[model samples]
Target: MARRILQASFVRRAALSAGWLAGLHTLAGCAPTLPVVVAPINCPVSAEQLARRCQAPQAIANGATYGEVLQLHQLDRKALRDCAAHDRLLAEMIVQCQRTILDYNDRLVEINRRIADKP
Candidate 1:
């Protein structure tokens, strides 16, 4: 009777060990994931240069236009020139220029999203 009890205890321990190992094996099959990385946007001109150009009217009316701003990936020079030509305050021009920079950045983000969403 003692031998039978020992055998039963051994079998129960083996069954428990097998169950625990099976659970571990199942968990091992599911691997941990890493965060996804995205590429940065490449702009042609710096924000400071764009802001300075926006503050200068002659620079805008002479050659700077919306097309030029878009091509250079800069602020809206024409809008800045219009504001300056209308005798807007220097502070206002700066604000408008900064707003233009934000607009440009938003546009670039949208473009990047569209490109990324392509099938």
Candidate 2:
């Protein structure tokens, strides 16, 4: 019957797929794995470096002209912005490093599982 033939074909295809997957797994297991060493993430500017990079403008002298005070305020705002930019950069670096560490831990778990399952 046609139904019987279809069932037989399906079974054959399933068996072939299973065998192919097993062969691929065997081949992957035979690959040479090298050691993976991850260096620690570095993300911090020293106090001196930070001070040198972002020093706010000194306060205007007493009885200063309006223009001088305005200029000083603008410089102070720019300095604050520069400091915030540095902090944001550092925060992004930390986030990326944390994600990488998490992924590395996950891969390590999978590797351990495969090692344990190996014959």
**For each candidate, what is the lDDT?**
0.64, 0.77
**lDDT score, candidate 1:** 0.64
Q: Clashing residue pairs, candidate 1?
A: none
Leading candidate by TM-score: 2
Off by over 4 Å in 1: 1-88
- lDDT (tens digit, per residue) of candidate 2 on 21-66: 9999999988766446445544444555544556757778999999
Q: Which candidate leads the pack in lDDT?
A: 2
**What root-mean-square deviation over C-alphas does model 1 reach?**
16.6
TM-score of 1: 0.27
Candidate 2, residue 57: how far the Cα is off, in Å: 5.2
Clashing pairs in 2: none
